[model samples]
Target: MKKMLVFSMLILVLILGACSKKEDASNHGSVNDGEAPSEFGSIDHGVDENKVGFNLTGGTIEEAANVPAEEKDLIIRSFDTYIHAFNNQDLDEYMSTLSEKPKSFNLDEEREYIESVFDEYELSREAKDITIVKFDEETGESQVFANLVTKMKQKSTGLETKRDGRQVTVFSKEGGDWKVNSVYYMEDQK
Candidate 1:
């Protein structure tokens, strides 16, 4: 009876230790630690699962690789237009790249709020390291995720301040042209 009790406790200890360690997602068929299953790349650290059900319009990964060079260039150009328009504050140009009747959220209020208080904030902005995270060839669509870092002047003594943010945009092919389908932006607190 004493031996059995000690063995049971040992097993429990081993099990607890295993549960406490971080599980490597790749070991269980997940692609990469940073590459979540969700289209938004949302990571649920607690549940070890990501949100799902984002059927973006794009060619499959295989198809995107086989895309003609000219078509690929067109897609890249459209993406460039989007980045430039945002930096230039060319709202019309930015909107033009988007799909007709596109669904836009989290912009109106945010923009109004920023515009209203921008004067109070010091602004030194730089957008760097824009990269194509993923593309689909079958649907001729792609997702562009970029990181933006900015420096906001400190209020009191005019010292420089810093801020960072991430944005994800979905672009789709329409009538042989690339257009933005949607956007998600997030800013980190400085």
Candidate 2:
């Protein structure tokens, strides 16, 4: 049952990933309303999908917040810290929100992927709708899924882009603190 929920959430993210990007006025395939981003020599892989930008926050509903902090509360806090730190380009601080060793869709590749995002663009992210897809009390394993809308601007060219997708992060306890064990993202527009 638990495995099924996780799988289902993964599929959900993929299908909903491009939902946000379609709203942009310039997103009709233009990089920046006609001007190209300045060449900082950043790798413009020309791919539309963002490999990073998973986001979540404290549940606004009182009933959701009423639960024990260890389960849902901690997950929210950790994720909030992650998004803020990443947007701030504080790699060390951002990495701290993750487990000492974390995994993404790829093994040990999260750091590299996030670094690329930080290096190339100035980013801001929002969690549109958050849902706890699954939680396991015994193992302190929790999966949070959310619709994410993120705007990014190339550092040099100032070319702005938006991506809408579904994001999922799995949290687990490490030294009594909630830390991200893994993160997955599905971008719809790309």
Candidate 3:
């Protein structure tokens, strides 16, 4: 069961990552509303040390507090809804937190993958060190980094597995709402 879970997660990551790269490449030169392109690059890449921008990669509460109150509240609320809905296996509510035009994967692909997970396992996830690592108001994009602890139990065999990881969830504004655009997760090495 643990092996299967790990395999599934690995596949999910690869597929979504590839989709994101393809979408970004295709939309590289397009600017919205005749506005200049954002200085901040894609969140999938590592942060550059020299960039003159928010440098809150430490994942601390103090760092997160530097973000504007309204934006911070909305981002965190959306993230919380995402986790809670997934744990509860509420598909509609879970999908609500994701963007209609996601950078990582299409809505249907995400729905199918998540549905499979929901059908096979019961998941409980807790997030800590939630911090806003980056925010670009002009682009309406923000990257929230967090430490995640998850436990999953196979529905059929009752086998359980646990994992700890660091996750970066990039949120983008769509229709005046902050929705999850992409995610990058790295599991802790044991």
Candidate 4:
């Protein structure tokens, strides 16, 4: 008799569980519904799993007007130039990607420090999984994340090595150009 009662309760619980509505994973808002979400939330608040960072503009969501094509191109080009300069060991070009004087971050890191590392090795980088974490169109402040595979060869012996890493850089539009405000390197890739 007790077993029969327990079995009936189990069936009732299963039915109730099945009838519950599926909760949205992305901040309880509708995303990917072929419409601009009623509200846009920052990463700290909660990111829409689908929208994630920025659908940005003219992509799948078709809202490129916010970021603008030219602004987007500038940031992307700046990052590309940074990568190209590093791979070629062009310190001047690489430094050009940094924020202007009085903007520390890499700037205050000192040229001798960078040159010391540069003098020790020949380096190249492979970047993937690049994404914009956040962007404020009005202020032109943004954050971008990416995974990097860096290959470094000892200058003296020519022994090459590679490391997997991730990075997030805060960028700001100064003088209508995107410049690195700061950089945060993440842990080694698993």
Task: Please estimate how well model 1 matches the true structure, expressed as its whole-model Cα lDDT.
Answer: 0.54
Top of the candidates by TM-score: 3
Across 1-190, the per-residue lDDT of candidate 1 in tens digits comes to: 9999999999999999987777764332224443423222221222211211122222222223455677667877887886676555555675577676443423443344444335354554455555455567786667655566756664667877565765556677888888876555456555
Number of backbone clashes in candidate 4? 2
For each of the candidates, the C-alpha root-mean-square deviation to the true structure, in angstroms, is 11.4, 16.3, 13.1, 13.7
Quote model 1's TM-score.
Answer: 0.47
lDDT of 2 by residue, 1-190 (tens): 9999999999899888965344554222224444442221111223222322222232332223334655576777777787778668787887687777554322234556677768888888888566566666686666666677878899999999887766666677788777877655556655
Number of the candidate with higher TM-score, 1 or 4:
4
lDDT of 4: 0.60
What lDDT tens digits, residue by residue, belong to model 3 across residues 1-190? Answer: 9999999999999998986543434233234223332211122333333331333343334344357899889888889998899889898999999888887556775777688788888888999988787788888988777788989899999999998876778899888789988766656678
Q: Candidate 3's error at 137, in angstroms?
A: 0.2
lDDT of each: 0.54, 0.61, 0.71, 0.60
Candidate achieving higher lDDT, 1 or 2: 2
- Residue 61 in model 1: shift from native, Å? 15
Query: What are the models' TM-scores?
Result: 0.47, 0.59, 0.68, 0.60
Ranking by lDDT: 3, 2, 4, 1
Q: After superposition, how far is residue 103 of candidate 3 from its true place, in Å?
A: 0.7
Clashing pairs in 3: none
TM-score of 2: 0.59
